[model samples]
Target: MESKIILITGATNGIGKAAAKELAKQGHTVIVHGRNKDKTLRVLEEIKAETGNANIDILLGDLFLLSDVKKMADDVKKKYQKLDVLINNAGGTMGKVREATDEGFEKTIVLNLLSPFLLTQSLLPLLSNAPSARIINVSSEMHKFGGKPFFHDFQLEKNYDSVRAYGLSKLYLIWISRHLSAELKPKNITVNTVHPGVSNTNFGLDADRGFFTNLVGKLLMRFSLTAEQGAASLIYLASSDDVEHVTGLYYGPKKKPAEPSDRYYSIENENRVWGYCSQIVAPYMDT
Candidate 1:
């Protein structure tokens, strides 16, 4: 297999880090994205030493802020001409109390949905530069519990719960991935989402999501898959030849194509989500 240039957001920890290390082991040019400079550098060196592959790099950006997301994309464009695989893996559940970023968008929405949308749009040219590129958005099974959609309440101004916010963000992410897959079909840029299952990672363990929820989360961690186990689907999607032509499909942790919940799906809703994301990131699109 031809080695590819891969970028993975949230590569500092958990499944993202696991995937990065594995990819680096395969001799791919891996760009590890993280918010913390110290942590990102440490992970970059760790991957290099562990995999014995020095083709690893790092990019720093806070996905919660659109400005940072745009700047990160710019940084990538400056460094590499073509990106073969982009894994939008940086996402987490916020605190129980809804918090907004400095840019005034909800934290969960910005990190999980808007940031990936903007980053993908900004990197389209680089992705197109590759003979064929892949876009993997790390969604979750929680999307099924997103409840009903309030088209006008994307920011969750009307109603907000930490889990709901996360679920909705992942759900919307899947919708946008589908929309983008179709739009980029002619460009040979395949797009897909993945449910990494319940992974034993620092994903939501630190979130202030009340007492019982936190307890349950901790208990789940004891029985959950390891980070490496959870990242199997991601590595497969990023490197396997079987899915080279597969686009717009959701993969489960089992490393096979699976059905995403369509309880709240519709063509209209998908288009609406796409339009909303495009509008939110329009200002950063050209910059």
Candidate 2:
């Protein structure tokens, strides 16, 4: 495989960082993305030292802002002519209450779904230009258990809960991925989503659950995959020649199919979610 240009969001920690390290080890040019400058720099230095791969570059932007997402896409496009892989690996859950961005959209939705949607949209031309490109969305199992988000209350304006909202965002991501799979079929770009499995990331920053979360982490996640293990499927999809032309599919622990909640299997839902995403990011979409 030729040296591929890869963009991975939320690379400071967890699955994102793990994917970055592994991908770099494989000799791919990795664009490491993070919101925090200090953390990104530290991780970048470590990656370079560990992998001896200097091709890694850092892209920083607050994903909650569509303008930042657009600017980040522009920044990435400027640095690389061809984008062979786009991994939407950033995610977070807003605890307990509803939160909105400066633009009045829900925080979780903006970060997890809208940012990826717009970033992928803006980078389409570059990705399509590559002979073989892939878009890997990092999704979660919560989406299967999480309830459907209403079309009318798309942003959860009337009602809200942090975990539920996060799941809905993942659902939208899966939906969007499937739709892009169909739309980009004729292009060189491929799109698919992945489940990283219950990871021990710092996403659970809430100190209130320190006791229980720690216990759960020790019991359940300790034996489970580390960030590197969780990121295996993503690295496979990104650099492995095995999945050439693979697109619009959902993967679980071992690239196996995890029956998505019935709703996610519907093309109707995918179309509707895509419509909603386009409507949400219309103002900031790159022309």
Candidate 3:
């Protein structure tokens, strides 16, 4: 419960917001992140007021934009010499259609997988400076197994489904995280992924399909999990002293190890994914 610096994304609401509040309550210098400036400020204020911990700061940006990601992480680096924890929790289904991001890539995969990989790489200096640090990525059990990301037509130009795209993004995240855990082993920076049980929160609702998702689907998702229930695995990985040295593993609620679906555990398959992502993000990887 030391006053360590921890930066978390998607903190305006839902699981990410819950994590910011819990970490602040525990006395960490929580840096809350969200794209909406007003909502981000509100969340920070609530956390500070509830925890009486004004050490919280806010960093705002769209996770899909690499420039925005760099800017946010760089801004944090300028202010803090050490980053005790990083929760890569910003994510969602980027709609059913395959929309290209500003960076000219599939939106869902880029936001959920590529953005975290890039952001974490960019923040390594700060993370490594801390005596002990952890990177807890919000991965999902859905990553257990699937066909390799279409290496040639990677963004599914042929056929695109929102649910499947989101799941594929999470699957890539686990592989990236597992690879990073190994790469950072010498540096004592534990890299782990968490399956924050499907807690009800706003993820899929948007303009294209607002009425159906917001009125019906969102209620069901919310019913699945109170934010507190969803944030459990994240909190465990972020704050627990028991799993301090645990790395390259998947965690579920109650701090239990998650048995990935049969398809996801293939080291060979994961390695294939690691190579692909690393190549794509190589230009941004300085360290």
Give the TM-score of each candidate: 0.99, 0.93, 0.92
Give Cα-based local distance difference scores for all models: 0.95, 0.84, 0.82
Give the local distance difference test score of model 3.
0.82
Across 1-287, the per-residue lDDT of candidate 3 in tens digits comes to: 56778889998988999988888888888999999999888888899999999899999899887778878877888888889899999997766557887687788888898889888988999999999899999987666533545655556677566666777888878877988999999999999998887677776766244356446666667568788888988888888898889999988876788866555457777787777777777765555
* Candidate 1 regions with alpha-carbon error over 4 angstroms: none
Predicted structure 1, TM vs. truth: 0.99
> Cα deviation of 32 in candidate 1 (Å)?
0.5
lDDT of 2 by residue, 109-221 (tens): 89889999999999988998899889999888889655866778878988676667878988888888888898988986788899988776666565233465446645776
Instruction: Go through the candidates in order and give the C-alpha RMSD of each one to the true structure.
Output: 0.7, 2.1, 2.3
Q: Model 2: number of clashes?
A: 0
Which one wins by lDDT: 1 or 3? 1
Runs off by more than 4 Å, candidate 3? 144-148, 207-216, 285-287
Per-residue lDDT over 9-49 for candidate 1, one digit per residue giving the tens place of the 0 to 100 score? 99999999999999999889999999999999999999999
Worst 10 residues of 1 by lDDT: 143-152
